[model samples]
Target: MNEDVSDGWAASAVAWIVEQGEDGDYGRRFVLDAPMRARIEGRGFRNALDVGCGEGRFCRIMQRAGIRTTGLDPTEALLARARELDPTGNYRLGRAETMELSAEFDLVVSYLSLIDVPDLGAAIARMVAALRPGGTLLIANLTSFSTAGQPDGWTRDGEGIPRFSIDHYMEERAIWVSWRGIRIQNWHRPLGTYMTLLLDHGLQLRLFVEPEPAGGDPERNAVHRRVPYFHIMEWQKPA
Candidate 1:
């Protein structure tokens, strides 16, 4: 949500593209995309607005699946990469907090982008406004358990067995994420905060998925074996 966060993403732009291709990365391949596609595939949505769509990877996926999709992001570098990858893609310069559109899209997607948004309320409001009546707004985000937990990681026992910790579930906080040379900031909000944001706008929850690893290094994804790595929620605007 901090406009300053744009600098982090801009710096990590090329690294993200290299690390997170259409069907790569542990999280993207094992959890996010399939569920996002499943939620979108059978629906008769003619168009979608992918808010905070970094590099337009997911937007390209939806477009290839025959859904007209527009990728919106605040970072200039990432948007440039998106355009380069998909010359015909509708990649636009926009921030979640101030996004406006004339067309009411049938679907609006927030994929791992909400964590970066500083003005979450305004963003959600715009997401609701962008949806057509009875349309869908889907999100795949870091679960509260993950975000509210420590950023440097958990305390390990003498045996080096790591255990995750959550110190503040109710308070909003910003955490610095540095991994694999990709540095960024992610906002952590309570579970109720996100649910209430959408419900307050009259969007009804239809599906919730706490994804476990589809297939990956068992040891690396072991956290998912007992704890959820991310959540995919499907909410619908009343018809």
Candidate 2:
């Protein structure tokens, strides 16, 4: 695990979330989307591992749906809140890449948290390892890269290099970068990149869902409609 990078990023991101209150912007919109419910149904997974689980929101959702869930995160504060959310549920403090648990889960999930990691490949590899043979790996996140031959519609100001802003790269990838007082870098991976990564890890792609923008600030919804902001992917580790 790249402790410094992962820990620093998790701490800062978790702090931002905590400051927003438990039901802040991210907690309300991103976490409560319908796709999460659909993934559990579509994949037929009863046991789950939530990588980068924050505040245990998703875990609780899974629990309600009858999927036994274990939430894992790098930030202690986040795990603390997760415990508060479900005292009987399991919560662990650890980096996704180094998560070592004896149990093999039927579903391994990473919410929007993967974007903050330093090495996404390593993180995915670990999740794959934790999955039971023939288990499902479901991921939902923002696409920061381009797709097919379409051009990216966003751009950024060089002055705010690592800061979150809209930026378009040559590969038609669109990235939304945002920044607070510290730890200033936010990037989403495109659909193509995500597929390639799954193939590289020998995971079979079963379903890919590009969710249409639902409800939020209308202005924000209009903006997300153009970019691949929300997606859910289900892959299987061949039985």
Candidate 3:
């Protein structure tokens, strides 16, 4: 992850989450929310990949849902925590846009980490390639360029990693950040944009999730109700 654009919180943030076991406080809050989980579980995917998976929380969830799952992330700390969480879980340390996998997945999904990658098109294209014909690609991210805020900016650190306060929000749906020297980026095409990309890549749109209001857990929900800001996109590769 680029340190300059992400405020130097990319890997440590995941570490904090793994240490705390809390969801939203760290980076996991944006993508792994309950409603999104419901959408993924409802799909009934048999084989799946979790791109930019941090500490493998979503991977564990996928396993419990009976989906055979693997996780991919670039950060060593996050991968270590993920391994600790699920020793048997399959995980690889690599960039999301350039992963190497032999098996095509029934579903390829990403949570909040897309905003940190550097090459959105290459990443999406690679993911599309990793899907089986008629398989699904599920992504969640900040929906609009204007809707989300940008990080501060970039500067070099002692470790030579560019450090910055930047968060990628793109006009054309491509967003990325360079932090402390590491560069991570993602794309956030609107619903139509995703449809077009899917079509161009030989995938078909299946579902699009708009932002929704969050309700209290009643039992003991701690998350304060707020206007939802993320989009959940589901697309399928044609057989």
Candidate 4:
């Protein structure tokens, strides 16, 4: 993770935890959970590693599905909270770019965490290295469009419709995002950057989806449908 990003998260950890609660915020509850859980549960993975596991939410989910999961995060406070919440879980203090484990997991996940990483290539290389042969690397990330619209997210037009504007779509940089008392730095990179890096590492794409919100919040779902912000990708390491 970038120094600023790390610092930002460390400072915002408490607010983030409060905002996330036990079930997670609107996006995870409404948009990401079902699809991500379905993909993992159907795969029969023996063991998994969750990069940036934050409070061990997804780790608990995988554990419930009968997959041994290790949750890793660089933030000490969050890891402490995770351990406190799930005392039986394997939670580690670590950064994605420098994780030393290798060939140990059948499934590795980055659930909305890649945006916080500073060295995307190095982090991805470490993730691929950690996977055993035929293992899966699953990712849930903010769409490039969403990141590119940062700093100035949404605006109201003459007709009162929401308009999302994108500028510097191709530039890779970090911007601070604040919401609900949480402020953190997130990296912005073009979509192709992620695709090309994963492909270059010899991982084959298995699934790519832009899941629509299925939760009961009609107003929130409508906004998400108009401009989907998250995408999930599943990739496989060669056997």
What are the per-model C-alpha RMSD values against the true structure?
1.8, 5.5, 8.2, 1.5
In candidate 3, position 234 carries an lDDT of 77
lDDT assessment of candidate 3: 0.65
* Model 2 CA deviation exceeding 4 Å by range: 1-15, 19-32, 42-44, 146-192
Better of 1 and 2 by TM-score: 1
Worst 10 residues of 4 by lDDT: 1-10
lDDT of 2 by residue, 1-239 (tens): 54435335554655556554555454246433676777786446788999988788778878878889989987776677778768999998888767776548988988877765656678887888899888988887755542221233354557743223443433432233344533423444555665777799899988877776556677666555555555678889988
- Pairs in steric clash, model 4: none
Looking at candidate 1, what is the lDDT of residue 203? 90
The residue-by-residue lDDT of candidate 4 on 118-225, one tens digit each, is: 899999999999999999999999999999999788898899978988899999999888988788989999999999999999999999999999866898899899
Quote the positional error of residue 130 for candidate 2 in Å.
0.9
C-alpha TM-scores of all predictions: 0.94, 0.76, 0.71, 0.97
> Per-residue lDDT for 220 in model 2?
66
| Per-candidate total of colliding backbone pairs | 3, 11, 31, 0
lDDT (CA) per prediction:
0.85, 0.68, 0.65, 0.93
User: For residues 26-90, could you state the per-residue lDDT of candidate 1 as single tens digits?
Assistant: 88887777777888886777899999988888898888778999889988888888898899889
Give the higher-lDDT candidate: 1 or 2: 1
